[model samples]
Target: MTKFNKTLLAAAVALASTQTFAAGFQLNSQSATGLGRAMAGDAIIADNASVLARNPAAMALFDEKALSIGATYADVNVEVTDAQFLGQDLGSIDNAAEGKFIPNAYYINPVNEQFAFGFAAFSNFGTGADLTPLTEVEGTISPVDLLGNTEVATINLNASMSYRINDALSLGLGIDLIQGSGKLSRGSLVEVEADGWAVGGIVGLAYEINENHRLGLSYRISPEMQASGDIMYLGTEFEDINIPLADIAQLAGYHQLTEKFAIHYTAQWSQWSSFDSITLENPSSPEQILKDYHWKDSWFLSLGATYDINDRWTVRAGIASDKGVVDEQSSLSIPDSDRIWYSAGFSYNFSEKSSIDFGYTLVVGEKVHVEEKNAILLPIDAYTESGANYFSIQYNYTF
Candidate 1:
């Protein structure tokens, strides 16, 4: 390999070393309309094949074949200011990252009244961050221009069984065969390395109350997802960082208020705390150990509604607040914070079995105060990160 490519590869490996080497973090995406409506009741909507990824029980609602394919574009604008290296101006920096296209697909099939199966691919988690021109260049700054990003992806094969317990209740159970991967990169001046694996499974359940109301839940067993890669800085091999992936939980429901309107809500919890820290195995003296992730558990709460405007048009809208897992000790890469969401969407029915769905979301990040001490030219603070914008479209078909 050429020197540039080798350097880039080392850089990539180093980048992956810093990120949680799971499948990459997921995009919190399920459906276009779900995005427009803040993902409320995504587990119970049972509107498309993607429902298999949320709550396996929702598959029971599909008595025929169904498929959903779509993507979301994310526009991220970040601003970092108040630079002070011993109280120097350092000049403020404002820039935006290239927008990302988040895409996913799902398919579901039903047999008789007691069984269903589906497959789905979606971003389970991921985050990206880049900082241009530090206060001081070279020796004065350990990291001159910081550019780092982490990605996680998952493909799940699922099977579900639904039983009609009675005239008023139906129950469902499901299993997920999950595959995941991760990639990392830093400092455009260097190469990027990516490594990760797919591992995770568990159970899911759902319940329907009458013909118009439903609830669903899902859980993934904690998996020791393995991330293996090489990290190189300035042409020197750094070390390898390995992380154990955490578990997930989801609960959601749908309630029809009238023939024309319905309301829904979702509550989800992630065991991020399980990621206490990562241990890097290296041969250097002292082994270059890093400590203190101290990540906390987080939650997401959302409320949304679907309105039938007419025979050909349906509308979705929602708002949500999702807590951050990062604490006061977040890294420079992903200056992550809690977020609030406002979203809206529409679905156009081309026919009873074919339709198009579109969604738009505005995310507002919470303002935060950060301070860096010790060696290196980090900073005493960075700006409150800006929220992101998401636009998505999906083509859905059922047979």
Candidate 2:
């Protein structure tokens, strides 16, 4: 590749970094009940089959077959303002991010007193944004290589099993099949489309201190995804691309202080430091680095409370703090920042074996200043703000 072409390709790839709803590119829309509680103690809360999406060991708490189905609609808003290239105005963009609906399903069955099985379908990562109009500013030279449309999505299908050693402890293991797809383009200079699959796993432990208190710990191993499609590096094309994903670890606790009141909390960590870079590979040539992230690890902390109002009504509320993963290296494409979450929800029981849940959450992000170099090495500066509203509904049945 020529020097100019190489520079252009590197700039475009770097700016095409994933922009998502949660910290890094992770997704947290797996269950409506979990969302209502900001995911606090989700790994140990076995109130419904949705627990299968977090820690399968919780399935041991079930004595009957249970099923849960839910979906979350996320309305994302991102504003990019004060965009300039070497003092020349490049205008601003409003609502660059797109809204999406995330769906999930789970099933759990208890076999005998010591064994259980469960299955779940959900998503852990996704992103969508379009900033291409920033490149169409009339008067000045635009940062065409740094602004574009980028979308990424992934789905996880899991099969899990749990074994109860005794009344106090349970162990669980799960295998995951992940399907992912990505699309990115910058005007007429760059375009990439790819889809592929990967495999990963999770292990969990659930400890019950008593009938009213419990603790859970889990770790998820993620794979370095490789996809094949039309990946253009300048004028050259590559057969495949490799993108590294991060592992996750979480610890949660639940306490029932009163007959009708309960409290829960969670501490979760993401190993984003391991997501160092993206690489392009071809059979005829050596592997090449497509982009470097150099991101840091991140944490999410949540606290929640649940109360039973009546025989048929239950209410819950939660709060959370999410630390951003991006450190010194930041880009206009990502617009990453620290965030806070406020959530509330309710459950209405129709009968002893059936119920419905409704949840809502508001995610607020801090505004941040971003600076990056365009294709011609001209520095571009902008201020970005991102936020979202999540509405969720779920149906749960037990037999």
Candidate 3:
């Protein structure tokens, strides 16, 4: 690999590692209905087919055979400003992403009245952004070019089971295997390869209190993704690096104010603090690449309400505050900060066997400033990004 290409790859990892928008390293676009209420108790409620993406314990609620398949379309817009190179106006443009389609599938069956089992698949981590115009910047690389327009994708398969301990109590467990891959391009180098196997587990408990209230608690253990694939620059090898990802934690509850309406909230904590940086370990030369990052831990708090409009239609709306992964050492590669999400969506049951869903969400941008010390040998005086708008839709089926 040429020296320039190697430098770009090193910068790519450093920048890509700090980009964020979802929980831990996962993106939630599984069920359109799930999007309506900001996914409040999606696993515990199990009202629609998307329940499979939440707590496998929710499978217990599915008394009959059920299957849910869904797709979400999202329109994202991002903007960066206050950029300077040696104190010059480098200009700015919208880094917004193209509309993307995210899909999911889940199936559940009752072995008996006491036990239920299910299988599920969905996207966890995804990377998408536009940086074609960044190349024109002088002396400074957009960091976007080093990581390509898109950088990461993760697919998860979960086998779960739920057991009803009593009329008022239930317990659930799930084992998952995750697969991931990414397309990385920097300067004149591009690398594409499959990341390795990762193992994780999920456990949840739900309790029924009286007739007006219900409670739930769930914990999902994250598995570290250890990938082994050739790091290619143009046509040459640039030695591989070991990337370690973070885990997830969620706690939620719900209450019914009326027969036709209900409200719920969720608090999620991700161990993003475990993410410090990425290191490229080379055996031949006993040398390590230069790419260090300082990322802070983040959290999400969501509240949502659901209204049963009719037998075939339900409406839901929610709001969420997602903390930023970028810290004081943030870079041009990830020009973002904390965000506020306002969303609304609905579900229409076409029949007892099938349903379709749609959702729309707007994310209010946060005020985040940029400053990098060891990158590009310069410090950014200030940096910030405007918010984004998103639209989502999905289809759910049961048989």
Best by TM-score: 2
Candidate 3 weakest lDDT stretch, 10 residues: 1-10
Which runs in model 1 stand beyond 4 Å of their true positions?
Answer: 1-26, 135-192, 233-240, 282-288, 328-331, 374-380
For each candidate, give its TM-score against the true structure: 0.83, 0.95, 0.86
CA lDDT of every candidate? 0.64, 0.82, 0.64
Q: Could you arrange the candidates by TM-score from highest to lowest?
A: 2, 3, 1
Model 1, residue 369: C-alpha shift (Å): 1.6
* Residue lDDT tens for model 2, 1-399: 211111122233355633555788777778889889888888897889998887878888889999999999989988888988878887888888889998999999898899999999998877778887777877777777777887766678999999999999999999988776667787676687766566789999899999999999889987665666767866678876666667899998999999999999999999988778878789999999866788899999999999999989999989999888888988776668999989899999999999999989899999899887765767888998888999999999999
- What is the lDDT for 190 in model 2? 69
Please list the residue runs of candidate 3 whose C-alpha ends up more than 4 Å from where it truly belongs after superposition.
1-13, 16-20, 23-25, 137-148, 189-197, 232-239, 284-290, 374-376, 380-382
- Candidate 1 per-residue lDDT, tens place, 59-107, comes to 7778899999998887766666664455554444564344667778888
Output candidate 3 Cα RMSD: 4.5
lDDT of 3: 0.64
Those runs of model 2 whose alpha carbons end farther than 4 Å from true positions after fitting are: 1-18
lDDT of 1: 0.64
